[model samples]
Target: MLRTAAAAILGVTVLASASMAQDYRLNPIYQTISLRGGFTPDPYVINLQSGGNNDASRTLGGSCRGWVATAPDVRLHFQAGSLPLIISANSSTDTTLVVNGPDGRWYCNDDGGNGLNPSLRWNSPMSGQYDIWIGTYGSSRNANAQLHISELYSQ
Candidate 1:
């Protein structure tokens, strides 16, 4: 019985230390729902108009962007692993977004075409969970943007 208690305490200590070693603080996602982006190359749009529009910092992985938001603002699963992982937001509102890939890399985009919406793509990333976010092109509290993910392939 004593040995078991000691082991439990050790496990807690290890976990605490490991979590403290992260270079980027992935804020707790109190609100989020993970789902497939379908099994095609079509873009699936999710409503993030009610998302949180505030992040402690705008510079993720050493890249700066607009109003940065963390999970709950956006969180997705890249099940379909083909080509590149595409993340885009509504262009009309100047909404920027980023992807904190499973491989400890930060991917952000300010604009990808049509208008001021931001889009980012990860080339052949390892299949896993990713933390998605929605931000602005500069710094604003506008949380009125729609988010979309495309180029996904599912089995």
Candidate 2:
């Protein structure tokens, strides 16, 4: 009887360990293109016509807008490519960038040059379509920038 009880307890421990393990896998690739015309008048620009020197770090120094889709319990991988063009923003107000989602409402805010980048990662809290809005404004106006993006869906 003692031996049988010990064996039963060992089996239960093994089963519990297996159930507690977490599994992470790569999801399929989803991608799209986004652009901002240099000639268009952007309300987010702080200095419309001021052509200032381009920052070498090229880090987003001003506010810009964009969106991403969301789904309950879903993780997404965002990859961005190099941008060769010059982009700028004004100093008066934060640049306005809007991110539109399918189920959820739009997300708009001033990003003091924090949005410009090679890539970004986002997770979905509610499943639905999403879009990113780029606000053009500030002394960074007329500055050109280009970037390619890739998204990997993961659960």
Candidate 3:
């Protein structure tokens, strides 16, 4: 069940359902990332906070104007290759991960890593913008999550 949630992620053009989707962004907006092969640059971690509407009536950030809560989007340009991305929250019960890439495809992850952490590798990633959505499973709890992103490919 978990394996397919991300694989079947809706395309970027697809609007979220009635439950509402999140709009995330990095606290410090970094446009482009520099990377060399075989080098894991220091992971930039951001605190995840979500706000919006479940009815799809409210939009938070620019990327989520028609969507829901605040899900951080890191506008990045990397070398054309597979970029290994690691996104983790405080715990598995806290959050899920969804990414919208330059190709206009959505990549999602639900509890992929140990203790609900989500990780994915974008193969043949185009050099452009990316929408990184941190979705909270349990809305009753505060939106407390940490995102760790690393550029795994070098040009």
Candidate 4:
């Protein structure tokens, strides 16, 4: 009976750890912001660090790259309209961008922004939560970065 109980505990622990690995279902590390198309002051900027232990390419699949945390850096509850939604990262270190769109699709970018930064745009974006993850390109190390969310331009 003791062995069975210990096995059950071990199983639960493993399951919990597995679930936490690069799971977008978790809450963001920063904060949640609500915005509508044409409601921003052009760009909504957020200061944050990029990179984490989880491998973005393996966890997020597709063309995703870089290393990212389990939880998102920021979550954007966006109400879309005629304008496009642009998400970008600006950092001295080479950085990557990963977004889980409201439509349950994953978007990733590398060097789409100015210099070595990353950016992704959704023209006619969906209205819901956008889980944004900013990551370093080379390895799993946090680096200073500014996340720019805009309807007009990217940086």
Candidate 5:
């Protein structure tokens, strides 16, 4: 009887250990934002809109009409930490959004002609601040854009 009880206790301990190990694995966290542009050059700053550290910064993806004569860009200011692995965007026009990281830049192209949902993945560097931009050569008047962010880390 004593040996049987010990064996049962050991089995229960092994099962509990396996369950704890699985529970400790990191899970991905996601955040989303919606942007609406006006007739005027209403550059939506993701950091400002999301309220700073709570959200990431954003820039024009590439060059717009007269504003931001260069590629549309979005600037982000981080808290000097690693970022998520996945970033996505959706718009009503063929647009490209680029994420400028501390190490390099990764881009997501949207060529749906009308608009599309696009996503890009990359390893973000640790930084105090970062910038991301989106834009197209043609004119996108009063366009709507959506941004999605996914972060994965072990607590």
Candidate 6:
């Protein structure tokens, strides 16, 4: 009986961890965009809803604030050059940004953009895939937000 109970507990713990794991390999919740340095559109914009059930600090760690979904919000395939790369989010409610860079590093920011938005800038960014997640501060409630990808300046 003791062995059976321990097995059941272990099974439940494994299942829960698997569900909370964030998989960048999976298709993003929004859309995937391929952009090269100096792409025609200066700032590529995508409208999305922010916040999720997963706790960013718990899942991502290292000052990763806010709540985000299990899957990425957007995936960006960037070809780098001389120019810089900027990712920002704009919303009425406070929002946060979490990115898994191509270099296999986690970058996060909160209120680094205009007003209560979040932004991240990479000078001389590497050329590869960037998985992005937009989150809401304080709570798990979703909020309307616009994600801006630009090489120029943040919005």
Best by TM-score: 6
Model 6 worst lDDT window (10 residues): 8-17
Tens-digit lDDT track for model 6 on 1-155?
A: 01222321221111112224567778999999999999877789999999988887788665677889889999999999797788889899999888888877777778767767777777768999998999999899999999999888776
Error of 2 at 150 (Å): 7.3
- TM-score for each candidate, following the candidate numbering: 0.63, 0.27, 0.54, 0.84, 0.38, 0.85
Q: Is candidate 3 or candidate 5 better by lDDT?
A: 3
At residue 155, what lDDT does model 3 achieve?
11
What's the lDDT for residue 54 in model 5?
10
Q: Output the worst ten-in-a-row residue range by lDDT, candidate 1.
A: 11-20
Q: Residue-wise lDDT of candidate 3 within 72-95, one digit each (tens)?
A: 434444444444444333443445
How high is the CA lDDT of each candidate model? 0.50, 0.26, 0.43, 0.77, 0.30, 0.79
For candidate 5, lDDT tens digit of each residue in 44-75?
22321111111111232222111111222344
**Which of the two candidates, 4 or 5, achieves a greater TM-score against the reference?**
4
lDDT of 4: 0.77
Could you tell me the lDDT of residue 116 within candidate 5?
41
**How many pairs of residues in model 3 come into backbone collision?**
11
> What is the model-wide C-alpha lDDT for candidate 5?
0.30
- What are the RMSD figures for all models against the true structure? 14.0, 21.5, 7.3, 13.9, 20.4, 13.2
Which window of ten consecutive residues has the lowest lDDT sum in model 3?
59-68
lDDT per residue, candidate 4, 15-131, as tens digits?
Answer: 112224566788899989999878847789999999999887777555678899989999999999897778888899999887777766677788776778777776668999988
Model 5 worst lDDT run, 10 consecutive residues: 48-57
Error of 6 at 55 (Å): 1.0
